[model samples]
Target: MTSKKLQVIATDKAPAAIGPYSQAIKVGDLLFTSGQIPLDASGQLVEGGIEEQTHQVFRNLQAVLEEAGVTLNNVVKATVFMKDMNQFAIVNGIYSSYFGDHKPARSAVEVARLPKDVLVEIELIASTVVE
Candidate 1:
């Protein structure tokens, strides 16, 4: 069996990965994006509460998705990590605004800590445009 080459997608709208990782990975027809914190395109965490941070996270995800030839509509699943589950309502409200039409399977959980101590982080699994 032949293996396909790994494709890396990078975007300026999202905070770049702090470690040795690409913003998103393309393997065949699937695109896997790394967890996105509330950092802006300039790689600085947005100064705000959970609400503003959530919005910035979505924007970052959007940039990565578009870079990989996909949109939020193509997302099949999402994993949302939060330092406090109590902020679910606020984050959900913002998340819903991004994908008003498509509803992807998602799981949200409270983590003890996140990189850079951001209030929220989101990662996604999406399907690429099938060639």
Candidate 2:
């Protein structure tokens, strides 16, 4: 049996983990990130509606992804947790702007609540082997 080395990914540009967890983890060619809420690097929740919140979440994701040596274009899968499904379209628009033409497999769902009671949270899985 063989085991792949795992590396914790983190950056000060993103909000620090509120609990006992790494911002992301890199194992082999994949980087798995923790769900990112709309908290700023200082760990305060960003103020605004879903649109602003979603954008902040992407910022946090970008920081973690960069720490793992990847980017949104490297993301193969994404899972979005929303407090309101009615805001999906708004979030989708902001999400599209970040990823641009690269579309990754995605799943979105309305959760009863999220950490810090924020409007939205997002997490990603990216490939470290960027071509």
Candidate 3:
């Protein structure tokens, strides 16, 4: 039998997990992140509409990714949870800017509610293998 060690990934740059969950977890060469809301490092939700909130979510994701020694470019899959599907276009634009040329597999869906009732939340899966 073989086992892959689990490494909890965290960073002060992002908001601390509010519940019994880690910011991210790395098992073997894969890093799986928790859903990040639009909360700052101090745990205060950012003030703004979908645009600002979405940006904050990305910032939080970036911090967690960095802690795992990976970048957005290394992300293999992303799951976005939005409060409203109507804002998909706007959110997609912001998402595009962050991802730039690296297009990873993504899934975005509208949910009834989210943590802190934030406009958007994002989670990602990244490859830690430095190839």
Candidate 4:
């Protein structure tokens, strides 16, 4: 069996990974992004409530995807982590606006904590070239 090469991707649009992890990894045509927090391109957390935070997370995803030469359309799956389940409805609403055309497989879970103490985080699995 041949091991796939891990391709690291970086961009100015999302916050840089705080630990020993790439913002996203591309193996072959697939791109797997790290969990994106509510941070801006300059690596600062966005302000406001969960809705705004969710939007920033999506923006970060967009940045990483663009860096990988793909769009949200190429995403096959997504994992959303939230600090509180009560923000589900609001987060879903904002997330819907970002993926206006396609529906990807998704799982949302509430966790006890997140990096930087952000309210929400979003990670994605996408393709380099849309099929």
Give the alpha carbon lDDT tens digit for every residue of 1-131 in model 3. 78999999989999999999999999999999999999999999999899999999999999999888889999999999999999999999999999999999999999999987888999999999876
Each candidate's TM vs. the true structure? Answer: 0.94, 0.97, 0.97, 0.93
Give the C-alpha miss distance for residue 95 in model 2, angstroms. 0.6
Of candidate 1, the 10-residue stretch with the lowest lDDT total is 122-131
Candidate 4, 1-131: lDDT as tens digits: 97889889999878888899999999987899999998887878788889888888988899899988999999999999999999899998888888987899999999999998999999999878766
Summing lDDT over every window of 10 consecutive residues in candidate 2, give the lowest-scoring window. 62-71
lDDT (0-100) at residue 7 of candidate 2? Answer: 92
Return the lDDT, model 2, position 131.
97
Clashes of each: 0, 0, 0, 1
The lDDT values for all models are: 0.91, 0.93, 0.94, 0.90
**What does candidate 1 score on TM?**
0.94
Tens digit per residue, CA lDDT, model 2, 82-125: 99999999999999999999999999999999988999999899
Could you give the candidate ranking by TM-score, starting with the highest?
A: 3, 2, 1, 4
**Comparison by TM-score, 1 against 3, better one:** 3
lDDT of 3 at 23: 97
State the TM-score for model 4.
0.93
lDDT per residue as tens, model 1, 3-89? 988999998877778999999999888899999998888888888899999988999999999888889999999999999999999
Model 1, stretches more than 4 Å misplaced? none
What is the model-wide C-alpha lDDT for candidate 1?
Answer: 0.91
